[model samples]
Every structure is written in C-alpha cells, then in structure tokens.
Target: DEVFTGDERWRGLPVPAGDRFAWEPESTYIRRAPYFDGMPKTPEPIADIRAGRVLCLLGDSITTDHISPAGSIRKTSPAGQYLVAHAVQPVDFNSYGSRRGNHEVMVRGTFANVRLKNLLAPGTEGPVTVHLPDGEQMTIYDASVKYLREGVPLIVIAGQEYGSGSSRDWAAKGPRLLGVRAVIAQSYERIHRSNLVGMGILPLQFLANDTPASLGLSGKESFDIVGLADVLAEGFPRGKDVEVKATRPDGSGVRFKANVRIDTPQELQYYRHGGILEYVLRQLRDAGR
Candidate 1:
C-alpha cells in the first residue's frame, strides 16, 4: 500500500491530472477510436448461414498468420489506403499487430499476408483471389467487399489442417468481418476450431479420405451447409455429420457429409447466439435487467 500510493517512484512519474486519461489524436493508444466500433453489441442468435459464395479456396496448412499477418503495409493495400485517407503517412502505417486496436485496419489486413497463396487465383501469390462467377482478379479484401455489397454470404473451401498454427483470434475475427459464414475443410487445429465456435463461425470438417480435390471442388461453387439450426433445434448430438451440397453455376454440384466441429453444449450456445462475446454480453444485460 505504501509503495503504491506513497513511494517516490510513483510520485516521480509524469502523471496527467484527470479522472480519465485525456485522448489525443497522435497518441497511438487509441481511446476514442478514429477507426472502429466495438464488436456487435446487439444480442443476436447465430442463425443458419445460407447461400454462401466461395470466398477463397486454400490448400492445407493455412495458419493464423495468413488470416492476420504482421508485415509492412503496402501502399496499395486497403489498410494503407485507409490510414492515408485519415492523413496517416505511409511510414506511420505500421504493421497489422500494431494497429489491432483499430478494427478497420485489422479487417483490411486480414488475408493480406504477404505469403498467402489463394488457390482460387492459381499462379498468384500475396493476397490476391479470383472472385467467382465474375472472375475479377482482386485483393482478398476487395473480393470480400464486393461479396458484402451483394449481400452474399461467404464460405472458405480448404484442404486439410485449416487454421493449423498458433491460436490467434484474428484468424476467425477477420473472416467473420468479411462475411464468412463457414469454413469447410478436411480437418482443423483444435484451438482454432474452438475459436471459430467462439466467433459464431461454423467449422465444418470433411469426412475421412474426402477433400476439395477429391470432391472435385473448384472453389467456384456455391455451397449450402444444411441442417445447422434445424439439427440443433431438433436435438442433434454434438459432432454429428451434416449434409453439404455445392452447386456450380451450370446447375451441376456434389453433395457430401461433413461433421459439425462444435464440441460442447456451452460452445453450441455461443454458436447459437452468434458468438461467445455476444452471448456473454447478452447474459450480463439480462442479469442487469
């Protein structure tokens, strides 16, 4: 107590006088955000994702670093352009990790990893993806922007071991912001699967020996993940097989079985409510009332 309140070290520190820390424009520690709103405040249940367009088709071993990377922001990138619009110069546009407090920057930097190679844009490297049906070559962020504008839900088609790196929340958060409703992969890293559930994103796992290549998925297909809300509503057990159908534009498609990766009852509740954060906030709000 004496050391905390009466010590010379505490007193010698430059303390700004106030009940609250004064916010300033140049202070990188953002208080009143020049960039973002907090997570979804309105309590909403996780509804079934429908008619999701293919966002990206990636190969095995995709990592959290691919979802949200740490690197120099390119002047041509969306996040860089945003910072520049706000009068932040190119040098002031730091890495994604540095600007995480700013959601706008983080979301833009998502899938902007310098090494990310989206299979949809074969022979392309570094954040580029081919927007399906339209076939426009653009940045991943740009594709997501176009999808969002069209009210099209998004899904990521992947090879095995999706999200197979350090447990990073932004891997899930970034996808969610891009309107990704589900990730259909051959397998998932355990913690990343949970993170997906926590973020209200469905983690769908392919059946044994089946994969995007084996299933002939070109990543140009429109996918329907059926029996999510309905199965849950009808007392479906955890980890049950779900039926997924993918339809190409030419009226041809494939149907297959994928297990819902939601593991526990509590996680299911979080998924049902859109996310763990939203579920917790709603519970707190209800208790207060």
Candidate 2:
C-alpha cells in the first residue's frame, strides 16, 4: 500500500525545515486559540459556585452527544449559520467533530443537538434556555453572553448518568466556554466526571438516595454550592461532602449534601487552578524557573 518511498521527492519543491512547526496564521487549525486568551490565573483553589443561573435542569441518560453534539450542523443552527454568515457555504458546513480547532464553532455547537430537551424550555428541544432576572428565552450561548455581561456564573442540574457515553472533550469544553461553573448530578459516568475536572468544572454527585427530582429542582432556582473550598483546604480527601442550597423566587430554600468527587491529589490540583491544562502550564512554568 505504500504510494512512494520515504526518500521520494517531487522536483523543485521547497522542503520544510527544522523541528518546530511553521504555523500558518490564517490556517483553520490554529495552534493557539483565542478562546483561551490569557494564561489562567492562579485559581483560588476554591470551588465555591454561588447563586448561579440554571442553564438546564435535565433528566437521566444525558449523553456526551447531548452535552456537546457531533455529526452535521443543521443549516439553521447557530454553528451552521455562523459558518454561512462568514461565507462558508451550507454545503461546506461540516461536522462539529471536524471543526474542533475552532472554539467559536465548537462553543456554538456545544449544546446545539437536535434532540436536547432542556427543562427550562418546556416542550421544546435543542440548545435554548431562559436567562433570568429578565426571563428572556434565547440560545444557550446568547444567554451565557448576557449572564457573563451581568457577572453571573452558570450551573446545570441533572439526573443520573449525567455524562454517559464516549468522553468527547467538547462535552466539557463547550459548557465551560458558556461559563458553566458547576454541574450537580445524581451520578457521573466516571470518565466524563474526570473530564469535567480537567476543564475546571466542579462535578458534584448527589448522595445515592437523592435525585434532582427528589430535590424538587424545577430548572428555575438559584444555587449556592458551599464547603468546596473548605474541603479542599482541609486536604483533598475522598468521600467529603458539600452542601447545595437552592433558593426559589419566593425566597424559600432547599439544602442537600453532594459528594465532592475529587478523589486524587492531581485532580485536586486541576480543580484548584481551574483545570488540567492550567495546572500543567503552571507546573511547567514553575519548573522552568
């Protein structure tokens, strides 16, 4: 099956030199992404996600595909429309899997699945939510934009097997880009949970007996996750629990315990400084010194 020998060369062709790659600035595969602009600051080793808006209150069996979809981008969808508007023809609007290098596309494609049923937009499906304090329904990205402008963080409340299936990276990256600070679920597919930690998103598990339904989450409440920072400070131990206090519009509240799922020293470091990439970067930076 070899098309040619290793020594084969076309005449008059310029050779690529050196061990370093010559990165093309206009190439679709950008070696560096604008999505991750600044070096991640020294995160406060704190995991306290307080009073954030609920982007979605979902039910069980939520797969990675739902969190960050694959396959063809629908022509009218956010990612597709963005490509078209930028002069990429509808025919050239390829699968999200192929557009991974572009954070703008992937972030827009984050929850843009056709079958996603976010409880916030009852009886409707796909990547939509209600941005509150104003209660306007919009695309999840747009809602996250408004929330970001308002200096608000975001959270997703969900049922069991929250991130089941293939550990697609964007399933975590997309939400984090949308400013999702935490995800409290009945249980997590182990790999996906780790991926969340890798992306610096706190993944909390409800005690085996408690489900989102049992907590009476309506996708309308504001939440404050307490004790994360204290737990981390006390030495990142296994089986530690944090409390989630959810407040309704009427000022009523519900409090419950969730297992802090960070089971390793490395995972703790990753979570502390916002994610694995930042943790590694910091380590390399320090080591070089």
C-alpha RMSD by candidate, in order? 3.3, 2.9
TM-score of each: 0.87, 0.90
* Candidate topping TM-score: 2
> Any idea what lDDT model 1 has?
0.82
What C-alpha lDDT, on a 0 to 100 scale, does residue 77 get in candidate 1?
89
Q: Which portions of model 2 show Cα errors greater than 4 Å? A: 1-31, 34-36, 45-47
Each model's lDDT comes to 0.82, 0.84
Q: Which ten residues in a row have the lowest lDDT in candidate 1?
A: 28-37
Off by over 4 Å in 1: 2-46
Task: Give the C-alpha miss distance for residue 190 in model 2, angstroms.
Answer: 0.8
Model 1 agreement with the true structure over 1-289: per-residue lDDT tens digits = 5655877767898877889867665544253532124655564544566677887889989988888886788888888888888888897787888777676787888889888888888898888887878899998899999998989999988887888878888888888888888998888888999998898788888989898999999888888787776767756347687788889889999999898888888888888777877788788888999
CA shift at 183, candidate 2, in angstroms? Answer: 0.5
